[model samples]
Target chain A: MSEFQPKIVAFVCNWCTYAGADLTGTSRIKYSPNVRIVRFPCTGRIDYMLLTKAFASGADGIIVSGCHPNDCHYTSGNFYARRRWIVFKKLCDFMGIDTRRIVFSWVSAAEGSKWADIVNTTNEEIIKLGPYDSYHKLSTQDILE
Target chain B: MEEIKKIARELLAENKVQVVLGFEKGTANKVRPAFFTKAEDIDKLIYNEACIHNIALYLKKDTCQHAKGVAITATPNVVRSILQLSAENQITEEKIHIIGITHEGKCAGILDFKAAEEFSKTQPKGLKPEDKALIEKIQAMSLEERFDYWVEAFSPCIKCYACRASCPMCYCGKCNVETNNPQWIPVASHKYGNVEWHMMRAMHLAGRCINCGECNRSCPVDIPLNILSYMLSDFVLDEFDSEAGLNSVFTSALSAYTVVDKENFIK
Candidate 1:
């Protein structure tokens, strides 16, 4: 049998991290192929509920990437996202969600290499964290109609 | 008790408020929320330790909303709810009157928005020392233990929504769990489904839950979900230095941010 392959989901902002990943492709910077990318207009648009939903949808790990502070195309989107992250991380930790499997980062449009590094390191870390069946099982569990 | 009754009577007699929201004798010595439209009905208006229910939730109901003015028996928790509601633009100060009741069961008389702020600051927050110790005990556990603990804690939820209904802050016309389009959460009350429901509730109530514990009180299964909100409220204060219920102008930490907001977690 083959080794376990973790299913990773990368929720990225259109302006920064998406462009940065694009630059990674153009620059021939290679990273793990385990991740599936979902794009949003800004980090502020990414709801914390989506993070929980990702776990339920069979994702072993998640990467939430956005523009760096003072660099958001929309001025205050990243700022709001940052404040939200503080509370979200605490609640996730308290609720027993393996926050270690979720990665948050600042990847600018110019930081393609940094994006690649984030993906590679997060891939290695998630592989070690193994499957998220604890949360994933909730979705697949039989729901009475 | 007579002081509150007299106050309610005066408010009704002077046409200061169309409805006086207080408590009346329920079955078997229990107290139930009672609305007094007539000045004479103030005789039945009662306030005591048994009147622990957060009656502030009625301020949003049709009876209170349609009234020309509302005078509510505001506990510290209810006052916090009212201030938080006003901050969210759910209620206006001019339409509602707060008859402040101290946590000790003494009436502080009628208070406006300004006086309510002082009353809230002086009152004890709802977190008990035992609950604080429980929070500490849970925080010390391993990540997997914490998860299993919550899963076990929320396993018995019937999703009766007593928690949401009792919560004055949970005034949304349609809760996310009820959204069937994407079906953000399941409506069923299965074990893990209840866990997901609680996680969503905790996150949504993060900075705004004034630690009222009404949700825990209203839960038929006795799920201690209120502790989760109390923990998040402390974290919100420590991280953002912002809290709810004190000021009408201040936004919750979740809804607002400064350029210098801390982000040591994000790489």
Candidate 2:
């Protein structure tokens, strides 16, 4: 029997985590190959609906990373995004979504090692949690109809 | 009820307001939203426990917009919605005259926006014990169990959007669900669509929901939809120390962020 490998989606800000991931590649940093990264101009641009769509698209886990606090290129986009995540995380937990599968982190363009670490650790955690069948079931049911 | 009618009569006869939005006895023993335009029709106004509909929503209607001013029969939550709406600039304070109703079923008489704000502040701003208990019970369930519970609760949704229509705060001219150029949310009422719609509704109302329970009350399927928004409201209060509808000039927690905002979850 083959060992299960999870499909992960990473929503990263182009100014930070996306550049950090690029740095990771250039630096020859080893990380999990399971993640598929989606770049947005800023974390503030990543809509909450996109996160759910990732799950609906068969992602076993998600990584949402952006600039550190007080470090956004737009001065306050990350701050606004942080506030959004706080409320969004609570809503997800209250609605019984497996919020554990969604990771929130700060990885700047200088933090190549941190970007690799987030992806590798999130991949392992999602592998242990198995397939995200619950959300997938919802998406497949829509197709069946 | 008579006091409400008397005030409605004076407000109309004096030309202080061109219309009075209140509740009246509907067919089938239901008290539904009623709009009184003439002093003679004021007697049709009714106020009771069954007068739970939030008539503040009518103030945004095209007919209500044409009125010189509107006098609305406002419960505590309805008054709160009015304050929140004023803060959002959706409605002007000068255009609304509130007839407040106490929790004890007494008429508080006609109040201007300032008095209405004070009235809402004086009212208890906590979840009802029953709603708190139900939320705690749901929180005690395992993740899989809670997911299944919501899926079952949402399965019966027919996408009528009576919840959105009835919400006083959901006064958007173009709702995200109605936008199809990019189709932010699916139009169908399938499992995913239902959950997304409800989540969007709850999120949009997070700090703004006044816990009027109108959404849940209006749901044809009896889906306890208000609990989600109420829980988010509670979350905003506890985490940000900001409460909606307390002041008409206050900033929303989601729209306004500070350098010192709490964020332990970020790495």
Best by TM-score: 1
Q: Which ten residues in a row have the lowest lDDT in candidate 2 chain A?
A: A136-145
Give each model's clash number. 0, 0
What is the Cα-based lDDT of residue A34 in candidate 1?
90
Per-candidate TM-scores read: 0.97, 0.95
CAPRI grade of model 2:
medium
Worst 10 residues of 1 chain B by lDDT: B187-196
Off by over 4 Å in 1: A142-145
Local accuracy of candidate 1 as per-residue lDDT tens digits, B139-237: 999998998898888887889989999999999999998899988888878766787788889889988988889999999999888999999999888
The runs of at least 3 residues in candidate 2 whose Cα sits more than 4 Å from the true structure, single-residue gaps closed, are A142-145
Tens-place lDDT digits, model 2, residues B1-267: 788888889989999899999888889998888888999988888889977777778888987899888999888878888888888888887778888997777889987777887899888767779899989999999999998888888878999999999998899999999989877778888988888888888899988888888899888899988899989999999999888887777788899898898877777
lDDT (C-alpha) at residue B143 in model 1: 94
Which candidate comes out best when scored by lDDT? 1
